[model samples]
Target: MVDSIIPKPKRVDGQITGLAGELFVAAELLKRGIQTSITFGNAKAIDLLAYNPDTGRSFTVQVKAIRKKNVFPIAHNKINRAHTYVFVVLNKPGEAVQYFIVPGTTLEEDPDRFTHWFTDPKFPGFNWRVLQDLGHEDAWHVFSEQA
Candidate 1:
C-alpha cells in the first residue's frame, strides 16, 4: 500500500492561506483543552485569542502562516510581551504542519533579527524569520506553564 499526497486543500488560491493558518492553530489549541476564539478581519492584529479556564490565564495570539518554505516575515509594528506568536508552516504537499510558539519579547528584544525584507522565488516582502535554533519551537507552555 502507498500513502496519498497531503489531504486536498479545501480551497484554492492564496487568499485562504491566512485563514487556513489561523484555523489550523485555533483547532490545535482547542484539541489541547484550551478555549480559542478567532478574531478574523483586518480590524485587529490579533488572529486568535486563547484562554485556560482553570488557571484563568488568557493569551493574545498573532498567527503567521507560511505555505511555502521560505523565511516568512512577521510584522513587528506592535510587540506586546503579553502576546504570543504562533508560527504555522504548512509544509509542502502532503507534509505535516509545523508550529512555533514564541513570546513577543523574543522579537522585541532584537527586532532586526526576526523582521526583515528579502526576495524569494515566491515573492518580495518583509517577514520575521522563525528559526528553530531559538528553542521557542512548540513553546505552548507559555500558556500552560508546564514543564
Candidate 2:
C-alpha cells in the first residue's frame, strides 16, 4: 500500500509558536528591568501585562509572529487601551530569528492610511511609508519616545 495522506497545520504549532514568542519578549523585558506577567487568555483586555513597580506604571503587550514582513498588523483594537503597544517582528532570514519592535500607536496614526496602502474594513491598516520616513529601525524601545 502507498501512503496517501497530506499533513495540515497541527493545533500545537500555533500554541508553541505563541508561547515561544511570548517567552522571547518576556525575557527581553526582564533584561530591561521591567516586571512582566503572562496572561494566558480571557483577560480584561491585555495578553502580556508588564509593569515597572519602581515607576508605578504598567503596559499591555500583544504579540504576533510573522514569517513574512507583511503577515500581520502592528497593533489591534485590544491594545487601544494599553499604555503602550509593541510589535515584535520576528524575521527568520535563516536558522536565526531577528526581532524589531514598532509602536502600535504610531502605526495607527500613520497618514499613509489615506493612500490605501493597508486596508481592512474591520481594522485600519498601518502606514508603512510613514514608518519608514520616521527612521524607526527594528528593535525594542519605549513607545513614548519616537517620531
Candidate 3:
C-alpha cells in the first residue's frame, strides 16, 4: 500500500527551494516595475521592500512561501510596522504560486505567541481573501499600479 502522508524534503533541499522561489517571486515583482530588494539576516522582519515612484509610498513586503496551497504561512509580529504583508504561496516543483497581501493594521490587531517548531503564533494561519493569484502579466499590472 502507498503511504498516504507524504514525507518532508531534506533540510538542504527545503532551503534551496525556498531561496529559488523567493528569487523567482522577486524577479516577477521587478518585471512588473516595482522597485524591489530582498534583505538578508534577521535584523528586520520584512523581506522584500518595494517602492512606488508615482505614489511615493514605501511598502514593506514580508514573504512566507509554503510548498502546499492548503497549508498557509503565519507571522508572529503581525507586521505592525510594515505598510503591507505579503505571503507568497508556492507549489512543489517550484513553479506555481500565489500572493496574499495583508494590511499592517490587520496583523497589528492579532495576538502573538511562541511555538516549538516556530517562534511565533498566528503566523501559519492566514486567511484566504487576502490571497491574490499571480502570474507574470498579472503580477506586473498589480504591482505597477500599486507602486
Identify the candidate with maximal lDDT: 1
**Residue-wise C-alpha lDDT for candidate 1, range 1-147, written one tens digit per residue:** 248657776665554777888998999899888999999786676889999876788888988787966666544555676788887888787898888887877766775555344322244334324456666667777778631
In candidate 1, which residue ranges exceed 4 Å CA deviation?
1-14, 112-130
Report the number of clashing residue pairs per model: 5, 0, 3
Per-residue error (Å), model 2, residue 30: 0.5
On residues 83-104, what C-alpha lDDT tens digit does candidate 2 reach at each position? 4544444546464443545555
Candidate-wise lDDT, in order: 0.73, 0.55, 0.56
TM-score of each: 0.73, 0.62, 0.61
What TM-score does prediction 1 earn?
0.73
* TM-score for candidate 3, residues paired by index: 0.61
Candidate 3: C-alpha RMSD after superposition: 6.8
Clash pairs for candidate 1:
6-94, 73-127, 73-128, 74-127, 74-128
lDDT of 1: 0.73
